[model samples]
Target chain A: MASEVKFEKVDFYYGAFKAIDSLQLTILARKVSAFIGPSGCGKSTVLRMVNRTNELVAERTRLEGRVLIADENIYDGVDLFSLRKKVGMVFQRPNPFPKTVYENIAWAPRIHGVKRTDELDEIVEKSLKRAALWDQVKNKLKSSALSLSGGQQQRLCIARSIAVNPEVLLMDEPTSALDPRATARIEDLVEELKADYTIVIVTHSMQQAARISDSTAFFLSEGAGRPGRLIEFGETERVFTNPSSRLTEKYITGRFG
Target chain B: MTRARVFDLSAKAVAWAVAISTMVFLILIIGYVVIRGVPSIASVGLEFFTTAPRGIKMQGGVYPMIVSSIYLTVLSLVIAFPIGLGAAIYLAEYAGRGRFVELIRFSADLLSGVPSIVFGLFGLAFFVYFLKMGYSVLAGALTVFLMVLPTLVRTSEQAIKAVPRSYREASLALGASKWQTIRRVVLPSAAPGILTGVILAMGRAFGETAAVLFTAGSVPQTPASPLDGGRTLTVHLFYLATQGQIEDSFRVAAVLLFVVLGFNLTAGWMMARFRRRFG
Candidate 1:
């Protein structure tokens, strides 16, 4: 449902120190884009700027340039709440609400005024199925979401995001906390979800980016106390196999982060 | 082997001694109160609660004082809950690292640390003399409201903050407005902790004597309205004890203890229920 997203000469700072510097990138519609970088290289910060979640940070922080969704500037006087609904996010750690499984899925729809119980039930089931979690939790919909295993909780978080029918789904290392099997399942789900929605994932795993992403961006910390900078961006195959920059080759070949 | 056995035995003995002593101290206080207060209850029987105070005689009841105490507690809670909760929400959710938040938090801490007698003086100077409210139930309720407001604000703020950050993010991602997220997700999750604070505030308001005495004027007769003067159960006990009506004072003290005990037990039960529901 999400159209292409474009970041044009965007710069971000926290106090005197910059976190992201003059970054330019485009995330094609209905494709999975992955940002791979070393620790503290502003990958997550870049991901957060897409939906304006970074605005929740202290007011002293600054942003420049623009992030556009479907050719409309998301940063220009748009109502942030509506922008967030269109651009949903899932964190690295699965943080489920302290509520029942059914209520977790139903929360978004209910907030948006989907008061009909039957419609809510359908949305919950379909979203769970899409997130690949319906079978494991169908019988225990009323159980507390915290009771789910780590992998299931992450999927439930995905279901929670999908239930709102967002156009874009942003993930910040969504599989980092998961085990191999769970991570594989989530990768499969992401591949399936790309048919319908635009997804931008920030991952530390180069293999994960190669496997699940259509495009990949590499970032590196410039120097001590300096903001991280974007190094290279291209198709996933080209970036991993035949990158335009030596830093991308060094990172993919396991020389260094 | 002998040294190890001796050390283990001494450690176990010390642990048992500490645990038993703590329990014994608690039991001793309860035992003393019951032993001294039971006889007074037996002397007056049900009249200790059912009949009106009869001029320093043990033959009368604590009906007016009991009713007045309940009235004041309810009124204070009604006034404090909304204001305290609103201030808490503003501090925890909206005021993020601002000067106004720091100022409010500092003032609330200062208010909590102020002694009850100081609050009584403020009530007297502000509500009684300045406002010309003059020794009424309204003055008593207002004084108790001030005494409990800081507790409610601090506790509710902690409770609201304890809600997970993910809940807010998930709610907002669903297109819910900021206030809607607070109402639907944050408040419901924090309800138990907020209720616990309210109950504690009620216990303090019910037992207060110094603040109420200065503002409420300790009228022994039943209050006809909020504007009328009244004496709460603690005030009645203070008067009888000071007036040297030892038997009557003991009766009133026993009744007050019973009421406090009943409230505490109910609050404990409610807390357990909330924990089971949400925790």
Candidate 2:
């Protein structure tokens, strides 16, 4: 599989404090890759860097080295608007705008200049169906997105993301705030989505990484006052059953993360 | 009773006494004004609202002042809203975190704190003399614009900042430009707050006397255009009282007080409605 996203010795800093150092990784196209680590291990940072979402972090945060999406370096004069259009993000919390469900999905397309009502209606329905939420919310398309339950809201966020029709979807602990049923539904959706879209997920759940990811990358915090590095990367089964690094082995076996 | 209990009882009594005194004083002033003002209002009756002030002879009417006050307020707000809102959006959403932003915020605060009389002088010097607007309603509207800009910018900035960060991130992630995000999401979310600030500013513009005294001269007849001299309620009231037309002055005071009261009630009702819908 061709590499869809690449990080080349990327060093990220929050003011004087370095969070990610000398990180090298490749996410394959149309596959689910999971980044798992203990807290503050820079897994989420790595995920956000793909689309330059970290640019919105506190003013002091600075990212050095190259982050490439497909073949182009995202940092080197890339049009941020188009780059974001091609790469969508689902945050930890399901942040639906204070708008109707239909508006939540249609807003992205509208801003991108999709004006015809019928066309927007079609896109909204299709996106919701793909996210497996159409059946539940088909009748209440005009209702406020906040009125949905936590699980449904998460799904609605996914639908909103897909509505923009991005090639890559970044999920930052998307199911962490969801119940088991909602989590399972999202996992199923992820499995279905990877056939066409490159999906990079940051998950804390070891089993979730094991069950859903095609490949897994293990990250470990280098004590205090040091940045996190990619310790090991390999096929999910191999990493779980027979890891290469001692830290990876220790992490999977739950010895001392 | 114990010492602690006695102390607590005394504290409660003091608080009650303070609160009641405030209410009592407020009622006393309004009661005296209402008692003195009503007979003049009744005697003048409909003519109070229908005819222009009869100056020097002190005929009883404030029709010109009422029209002038309304024009100044509406025109000033119309001109000030966009400029103030734009500055606020820059401070809240676009400006980087640095001393530059700090300087701008500090400047706005300082301007707001400056006495309105100083602003009147500024209007007199800059607009009336330099710009040669020449003591017209336009000059007065411009003066009030400066007077109200700080409040508008500060409150609108707060409103914009209060919009959750997630909305901005979500909008940006969806390929919307920063300008687009602000126009579509941030502005709509901050609408109620902006409107409330505007209403309060309108009230301030209506009640202002010093700022308009030089810029908007107290013309006897009603103003016909922005270039014409106009007198607001406060200016007319000042003229009436200072010239010893106490009864006419009371009628003007009653009118000013009720108009300000209406503005406050409308603002309060709007904010309450906004909170219920958004919260």
Candidate 3:
């Protein structure tokens, strides 16, 4: 169910300000690619582009060049709804809908035209099981999602997104707002999920990137109000231990960022 | 006592005095109306509510006026709700923040600020005369719709905007279209606030007098259809008070107050229920 993501000569702008500049990369299928960088390095911006969710920002924005998924150029002719159906997202914060746990998981599938009650029930159960939230929530599917703790709420959001069966899952600092235990749980979930879904995560935690990701991409900007560039990209082990770029080595050594 | 403590005590006393006096004044006004109205209704019994006027329009009941008021209020709300909600949704969700959106918002604010008498004149010239609907419930309802539209749209817009943007993002990320996101998530979350606006607008429509008087006429009869001219309760009461039919006017005032109070209470109850579910 997973697909490779390719970016070629990509340039992104918010209004007239260049955000990400002249980037080219390939994210392989069924692997977790972690984008580790300091704040405002345009990592989240790159993650959002896969689903074209960046267009939801109120300001004027433009994306130049091609982003391909499964060998299809998504920007050329793909339907926005279907593109988003194939690429789901989880945010920095837990944002479950103000609905029942069952309804939250069932919502996306219902929108994608899964109408039968029995089918919805199955999806809810399966998605919750996949997200490791079934045992805690199965007894109270009718209860509001807000009743769940912050960590459980984040998992619920994951379950809700995956219920529609997307090929790729984009996480924008999904564990940043969580506690250590919650963050660890999400990391483990990612490891399990990468077997089926192509996962891309943006994180401030370098250790998390080293611990879970297969390949890691490091992005950096020269200063404030400047465009972000990909500093380095390679297997996580080599990137952390024997990085090719001096800046990546300096950052990984905790000397400067 | 210390100067700071003295100032704090005086401020507390002033706030308490203001709050108590406002409550006292409201109760006094309502009590006065009830005293004058209830005894008269008690004397007349069921005939006061069921029968039509007799003997120079002061002898029997206000059944026709009550019927007209309900008809005009219901019709106006039915007409205004969808249009106002649509405009509100466009402003809050779809419309880009720009000069045009600001101009639209300014126009709505200006419309709500215009006096009721001016609205009455416009209703007379537009709905009653130009449109050739005559003095009827349809004309009155149309006039009331125009009068209450700004309030409905403004309140609904605030409610819709209050829904967290994250909810929209979460819905859209799952591949729901903009319309699907709005219907399933945005609208349901905004329902309680929108309902409050509608009920408040309903009270405004029901209590409206000058506009309805101009468009609906002062015919003392139950309307057979929306096209039929009729007298609303406020118009009947105005006529009664000016004609020295003090007893009937007080009774009409009492009924009007109770209905508006009922609307406010219902809004409160519904808001509590929605909050419980949504939270």
Candidate 4:
């Protein structure tokens, strides 16, 4: 597998305090890579670093080091508009605009310069079908996106992102707000989606990382008032069953975070 | 009865009594005006609504005054809405958490608290004389726009602040620019709220007496231009009362009351509809 995203000697800080300290990792394309850790472990920080979603932290934040996507540094005066369009994101909560389902699906395409009516309709259909939501929502495309259930809204959000045909999809706790049934459905969807796009997920559930991800990176904060750093990274089977580091072994065996 | 139960009942009784008395006072004022107005209105017939005022003769009706009131209210809104809403968006979204923003907010609050009579004096000095609008509808509209601007800014800022933060984040993450996010998401979600502020400002502008008395002259004619001097209902009623024309004052007061009541009803219905759809 080729490396699609590489974080080289990255140090992320929020104001005067550091959040991510000296992290290094290479995520491969067309694979599900899970970053699993306890709360405040900077796993979510790592996930946000990819698409620069952390830019809205509303505090004085600074990043040192390179976050390269396909061997290109994403932070060095990159065209953020096109970069964001190419790398879509699904938030923890399903926040659809105060618009109809069809508008929600069509909005991304329209803004990204798709102006033809027939082309937009076709993209909306294909995107929704890929997100596994076309059948359930086809009849009610005119309904408000907010009217759907939580799970359906999340899927719609996914479809909305994929409408832009992004090269990567970033999900931040995509199932934490969902019930088990919805969670299971999303897990299945991820398994199928990994065939075409690079999927990066931030999850606190160890079982979740074990079940779906092909590669896993374990992270931990050393102690009080310390920034989190990566502890281990390898194929999922070895990371869970035969971690080389004592810290990764103890965490996987439920010793402590 | 237990002491606690007795005290609760008495408290409820006091609250109900206070509320009912306020309602009664309102009703008495409206009722007195309507009753006193009937004799003069019946004597005048449809001429009250159709004919222009006869000025000092006071024999015709107040049609010109009604037209002036409508024009003044609409013009003030046209001048104030865009500027006030823009200021509000800046305060809510772009303003820094610093002493500068604090200074702006403090100024807006202080402006709202200044008396309408003070606004009248300023209008008399600045708009009527200095700007050379010369006691015209434009002068009155510009003065009232300044007078009600603080209300629009404060209320619109509150409405914009009420939108959820998640909406902003979601829009930005979708590759939409900051302006696009605000235009599509923030403003739409804040529309009903800002509209409430607008309606409240309109009510205040429509009934304003002192500001218009100073700036919007007492000319009783059908104004053909914004530059032409005009007389609003409140000014007409004030003139009649001061001149001891009790019956004419009563009729004008009744008309003003009904117009205000109509505005309140529309505002209530609009707010209820907004709640039903967006809640």
Task: Name the weakest run of 10 consecutive residues (lDDT summed) in model 1 chain A.
Answer: A53-62
Candidate 2 structure, TM-score to reference: 0.89
Clashing pairs in 1: none
Q: How many residue pairs clash in each candidate?
A: 0, 0, 0, 0
Which candidate, 3 or 4, would have the higher TM-score against the true structure?
3
Cα-lDDT of candidate 4: 0.88
Per-residue lDDT value at A244 in model 2:
90
lDDT string, candidate 2, A1-257, tens digits? 22399899899998999999899988899999999999889899899888887877766778889988888899899998888888989988888987788999999999888999999999999999999999999998888887889989998988998887898999999999999998999999999989879999999899999999999999988787779989999999999999999999888889876
Tens-digit lDDT track of model 1 for A141-250: 98888888989999999999888888899999999999999999999999999998999999988889999999999998866678888999989999988999988888
List clashing residue pairs in candidate 3.
none
| Candidate 2 docking class | medium
Instruction: Quote the positional error of residue A154 for candidate 1 in Å.
Output: 1.7
Error of 1 at A125 (Å): 2.5
Per-residue lDDT of candidate 3, residues A1-257 (tens digit): 99999999999999999999999999999999999877888998999999999999746888899999998998898899999999989999999999999999999999899999999999999999999999999999999999898899999999998998899999999998999999999899999999999999998889999999999999998889999999999999999999999999988888766
**How high is each candidate's TM-score?**
0.90, 0.89, 0.95, 0.93
* Comparison by DockQ, 3 against 4, better one: 3
- Model 2 chain B worst lDDT window (10 residues): B270-279
| Ranking 2 against 4 by TM-score, winner | 4
Please tell me which predicted candidate would have the highest TM-score against the true structure.
3
Comparing 1 and 2 on TM-score, the stronger one = 1
Quote the positional error of residue A75 for candidate 1 in Å: 1.8
